[model samples]
Target: MKKLLILISILISLQVQAQRTSAPEGPGSLTFWENLSKHCGKSFEGEMLNASENDQFYGKKLVMHVRTCEDGKITVPFHVGDDHSRTWVLTMEEGNLIKLKHDHRHEDGTEDRVTQYGGLSSNTGMAKVQFFPADQETTDLIPYAATNVWWITLDDTSFTYNLRRINNNSPIIVKFDLTKEVETPPTPWGWED
Candidate 1:
């Protein structure tokens, strides 16, 4: 009887573990972006300048804010220039895949440049971001734009950004790695350290 009871307990534990790791449906599917939103209140300082020029906007600081809404949409608000602020929406798609929609606009509600398609891949603590080609009608607006992938690592204190340009014809492409500075205190208002 003792051995049978032990086996039953083990089976129950295994079932619970399997459910914990199972993929959820709908809004629950965006677990990756949900985790990222936890860092919204905290600010990460980083810079992304022209890849070729490098010095044109070197040392310029940018703030990254990740906000997760109640409807399960994650918004990443990024400031590039002094007066430019862009927000990207991260949501889950049909095949358990994550999609990021870039909504770039001016302060007056005019669309500046919108790339409504982006791809996301996450495993463990690593993430990959891929920006898709712009829409057909808006091709002329963003001529120099091409699809690019960025590899990122997220941890309790900081995040790393590794950029890569993807090309089908080119044999050689460029890659750059940038680290963001994050300051997390020992304990915040509502949570324990």
Candidate 2:
């Protein structure tokens, strides 16, 4: 009877450990989405931390505005110097999944040729960070970006946006200071008020 009890205890311990390892961390992607939504209607200043000389945003002033936030969607406009052509649309899908899409527009309020390229969160990411691997739609929109994985990390002091491509050593990392709010820039191209 003693040996049987010991075996049962071990089995129970193993089962608890399995559950701990398999469960998503913190409140998963919903928590992350909520954390990000906390910055709605605010603007922040950022610097390109890993830009190469040839990078388009190398010498530009970077700004990001959490322009709109709704229950299931958030819209952020990323302004590079005088260019207000880039906007990020984040949508919460069913099952706690979040989709990130880039909305590029011309100065005349028309969609750019290379636009709406992004991905969906593959799993329940942590509360502070989430990874979005290139989806089939992203690959169809931009074949060369098939291996791109974009991640966003939000914390009390800073928010970071990063991108890495498989087999590439260099990554694009931009960090925005969340401690200080900046003046909201003009509306992004193709957006009103």
Name the candidate that leads on TM-score.
Answer: 2
Worst 10 residues of 1 by lDDT: 169-178
Per-residue error (Å), model 2, residue 66: 0.5
lDDT of 2 by residue, 106-189 (tens): 999999999999999998766667779998988998898999999887767888888877766677889999999999999999
TM-score of each: 0.52, 0.85
Encode model 1's per-residue lDDT on 1-193: one tens digit a residue.
4554475359446544654666444343344455566666554555553333444334444555554443546665554445344555666555555555556666665665454534454322212222223333333444444454433434345544433344422211212212443542222112112
Number of backbone collisions per candidate, in order?
A: 0, 0
Q: Kindly report which residue pairs in candidate 2 clash with one another.
A: none
TM-score of 1: 0.52
RMSD of each: 14.3, 10.6
